[model samples]
Target: MSKQNFVIGLTFVIGLIVGGLAIAVWPAPPLSTPAGHALSLRVPKNRQLLDIAISPDHSLLAYTAITDGRTRLFLRPLNRFEATEVTGSIGAAQPFFSPDGTSIGFFSNGFLKTTSLYSDGATPITICAVPGTPAGAAWRADGLIVFAGPGATGLREVAATGGTPVMLTTIDQDAGETSHGWPSIINDRFLLFTVGKHGYDPRLTLLDLETKDTRPLLLADGGGFVVTPSTLVFARRGELFAHHLNSKTLKATTPKNPF
Candidate 1:
């Protein structure tokens, strides 16, 4: 991989797990070095967490930090030495970058909003009105944003420019899934998300965007996942793992000593 691609892939794979706590980014199981370890990223002034994200170009890092009982968004240039406040207000969480990485989408005060990295103030995109909270979200290459629906209503999608989010799939209550969230776009046609109750083990579900069909992908136990060009990384039972994936089908293949 080129230096730029390496940075983007690394950020996506690691940022998936930086919610609500201080954490370290590990090499994708396949990329483990001889020492089988990776360097740590120290987040500054981090008290409580909401979410974190990286731009497509791997130039910027955005995250939410709680301090003085108030939540705010922070941004830092990966090549720079310090972080700075991006959003002057509280309530922003679940930050995601636009496809081109020029703007950021987030959930604040029960609504979906976006703010330009070069401008000021967040603009409301949609009134999701999700009860409790929306579980997870992702931005598509074709300008669509997919997010977890209110309660157990499965997943929903809306235009990146803003509109009513339409239901993307139906939830199967009989499957023992309490709700679905943490959606990550696997490719142009597929998405991966988490489904389960708070105390129960959560599994990853793959959604076919074209057919709206859903199937179990893996047991994540309510953790996060990411799909890179040559591997699939996921978290389960507090451990992170990577497995070989058929590039075309995006399905797991036999394990190869990852990396």
Candidate 2:
């Protein structure tokens, strides 16, 4: 088998027990990993980090840090650097930078407001276009911003500067399957989100802008996917997954469970 195929085959398993907040889903079965291990890092004790954003050039990473009823944004250089608290005591999470690297976007409003990042510690400009809680910002390559929100379908999108947001999912759904995880961008024109269901399972879907279609990538837990310059890295169940953007091949990336 090709290395990429082997990577996908051994990356992640969709069916495993996470066990939190009444976690339950349709059994997708456990997948195995034969490839080498993907690197892993533990979230700081008592501080739950979520919605990680790696820069397009892969130079830095930003994510939300929450604990003790407080939330803030953190940043870390990818190479041999400890993560630093970027904004302390700010009710911010789910951060994404603009295409030009001059600005960042994250939800600041307790009700999910989009705020732009600036260097001079200036007040963040609220982008009235998108309404969100935590999972409210995704920066596209062209500087267009998309975010998940509450509306007819529990998610919406707007531009970076601000304007009328077009709902991504036509069907009404919960914001997250578990614990309000943010929507992940699959590519420039596509994204991945979940539709919550009771007594059944949350639906993992890929959103296509051109077709206005949300394709099912998995049943309940196919949410997190990181896009490197050349590949897309994801984790599922007890393993990791990768899809090469250049070759357009899907593979398992981790030797063990990344989640």
Candidate 3:
């Protein structure tokens, strides 16, 4: 073979080998394990741990423990199995991690707070204050916060940066036979968690942020915990399902007593 052709062939083979080596050398993302490793011996029994939330990075787990009819936020490391109380405030509900995992967003004292996990009393920044109890909280990918509460007319959206929250849902919008509870941002749209007489008919609906075009994602399933525009993880009955935001596909990924 000619020297020119031989040199070209050798270069191409070297490039292919280098490309594979690069991939092998790179580090992999952290893996998430189930939250019941340490409690295997102590409290081998698990009950309905409501309002479970993981840090944005999936490093921390925050959930509400409804013991004796009172709700409190518990923070536990997602890696090692151990639970701790993060807040001692009255009526603390729905503790969620910030998208950056640097802080946690929760509702207490009729207001939403952003607390840093790495510091001691690092000053819980206020998101907004409303009338009812634990106002709903959901963090956006860009760090914007959205909380739901019964407004003078209906549900509203208060900014996480501390300001007025504009009403995002109408009083007339019905969920089975009830009103809508706004959850989080989905597909650059709004997702509301609504309950009715039909035994927790969670739905995945949409509203055009710019044009206000309302639509349904899933009609009669449980609500969604959306992580991105084209992806969502939702719990129905006792199972978790992954939803493709575009194709509308549902795939279950959970064990016994899921959701």
Candidate 4:
């Protein structure tokens, strides 16, 4: 098959595998009761959903979909059925919401950008140029954004509005480290990220924003998130695992357990 045909076929197979998934929001407590509901996402015919992110406040959901060979971001309010296209978000991917939920940060055309959700026709404001595809990013509470840039090691940070990005961690090549990405900020002083190496499982690592110290929490296949102050959730082989964390000390208090 031709290269274009091969790409299309691959996308179709991926869509078939992932399209049936739905977003389920479980309510706090009442584990025996069915207080949660699934959000059935609607994608345009022939388009495939690329990524999805919920707003910090849980009021809106932003996702990227491939339409007519281009990818763009779409905003869907939790209470509404229709999803609205985000203006100037063409080529967007791996979107993350700002702390206030009034704006979104995304990667588009080798640049890290942000756009306001409340604006009538807001254009994306470029923050910095990234050489390769970013693994993931997080918006910090202190008007800064941390991201795993396309590089061999370490992470970078840039101002929320727009500015030059600076390296946030040192390269640990002696440990056979290849890349660092999938940053999840856990308050102003702590962060969670994935440390990757060739031919090995990715390590879920923690970083001290103040001291620049890092420690591996566990082996994971993908990035992780700080679901709660004391709960760190990560993915491995299509299954989710949770680690009990001491939020104040930034340490893993228990072994990895299935979530």
Q: How close is every model to the real structure, measured as TM-score?
A: 0.78, 0.60, 0.62, 0.85
**Residue 25's lDDT in candidate 2:** 41
Candidate 4 to truth, TM: 0.85
Of 1 and 3, the candidate ahead on TM-score is 1
Of 1 and 3, the candidate ahead on lDDT is 1
Give the alpha carbon lDDT tens digit for every residue of 1-259 in model 2: 5533432233222111111001234334326622222223356787865555655544556666677777777766645347766643277755766765566677766433334345444556666633443444567776566666653354666766767667555554353333223465655666666655545554555667667765555443335454343444444443454454443422223323233
Q: What is the descending TM-score order?
A: 4, 1, 3, 2
Give one digit per residue, the lDDT tens place, for model 3 in 1-259. 5533332233222222222212223333226522222221121134235455656554566666555566666677645567776645345666666667787887776888777787674557777776675335667665567666653244566655678778766655343344455465554445445433244554555655557766665542334555443445554443444445553432322323322
- The lDDT of model 2 is 0.51
Best by lDDT: 4
Relative to the unseen true structure, what is the C-alpha lDDT of residue 38 in candidate 3, on a scale of 0 to 100?
A: 23
lDDT of 1 at 94: 72
Candidate 3 global CA lDDT score: 0.53
Alpha carbon lDDT of each predicted model = 0.67, 0.51, 0.53, 0.76
What overall lDDT, based on C-alpha atoms, would model 1 receive against the true structure?
0.67
Which ranges of candidate 3 are over 4 A from the true structure? Answer: 1-49, 66-70, 87-90, 133-135, 151-154, 173-177, 187-202, 227-231, 235-243, 247-259
- In model 4, pairs of residues that clash are none
